[model samples]
Target: METLIKKNQAEKQLGLGILIVVIGSVFLLRNSGIDIPRWILSWHTIMLGAGLWIGYRRNFQGGGWLALTIIGAIFTLKHIVVFDFELSRITTALVLIALGLYVILKPKKVTTFKNYGQANQSDFKDLNS
Candidate 1:
């Protein structure tokens, strides 16, 4: 219970830190007269930021966030530059390839017993009886 509480506190601190940095940068950039797009404050930006935070904090196995980041980035890029390619098809193919590679390359865990049934064949005999 204590460990859980501590972990929760640490996460809260991390969230607070991220919030402060994001807010500070936004205000600072605005004050400096930089052209900040209104979309920066949009729901997409929130999702993107959440993805980045989760990816960094949880080391990418956190799911949804990584996908969110990828999709958000693709959409953001499309806005900046027109592309004639089938983006969804390409993205799907790439994701499938990545999954295949992970399945093929990920390490297999091996389990071993220091002593099988305490080296007693009676362990099995008792089960049979």
Candidate 2:
């Protein structure tokens, strides 16, 4: 268990280090007048990067990163594709659907009350005494 925890910590640190380096490199290149694509510097790309970083930090077990990634992807796609219908409405619907699915499918945590009855009985006995 101790070794596993150390390994996970190391992995998380490595991920953060790599992310920082990549972000720094991008900024450096931009400042040097290297013409990077506009899309790569867009808000959607930032959202995607944030999602990936969060996912890496959490070992991808949590859904928060998934939500950010999906939202970013949807917006990015909207920019890339010329759809006839309203994409905002579709995005809202998709968000609702995903939320519903997550609520229904998420794992339930089981909580156990240990020695509750015995504790209550002891308390009653003490009160009477």
Candidate 3:
């Protein structure tokens, strides 16, 4: 009971953090005098997405966002880094291919439904009973 409560509380707090980030982002973006178009704005989209995902997870619902985060991080890094264009393109292609396969052909949920601090199962249990 206590464990469940703590888990729920932690999730709730994480959700609140995400919400704060989203709200803060909106305010900051509005205040910043930039030429970036609102329609293609990356920060707002990411902020809103993170907030929604975290809110859903607070209720024990899962989303395939962790995988998306990995893909997004790789793409963002590729965009920001000043590597050779050909090398960057190749790396980006490989990353997209791998991530696309994981998204489409995954055997099961990659992450176990538990706290990151908890121990992970090292062996699979066959349950045919």
- The prediction achieving the highest lDDT against the true structure is 2
RMSD per prediction, one decimal? 5.4, 5.7, 11.8
lDDT per residue as tens, model 2, 13-86 = 88789878987898899899997656666899789778877876776667899889877867764554335665
> Which residue runs of candidate 1 sit more than 4 Å off their true CA positions?
1-4, 80-129
Candidate 3 C-alpha lDDT tens digits along 25-78: 866877796544353346535643654475346442344555555554554444
Root-mean-square deviation of Cα positions for candidate 3 versus the true structure, in angstroms? 11.8
- Regions of candidate 2 where Cα sits further than 4 Å from its true position: 53-62, 78-129
lDDT of each: 0.69, 0.75, 0.59
Worst 10 residues of 2 by lDDT: 77-86
TM-score winner:
1
Colliding pairs, model 2: none
Please give the distance, in angstroms, between residue 58's alpha carbon in candidate 1 and its true position after superposition. Answer: 3.1
Better of 1 and 3 by lDDT: 1
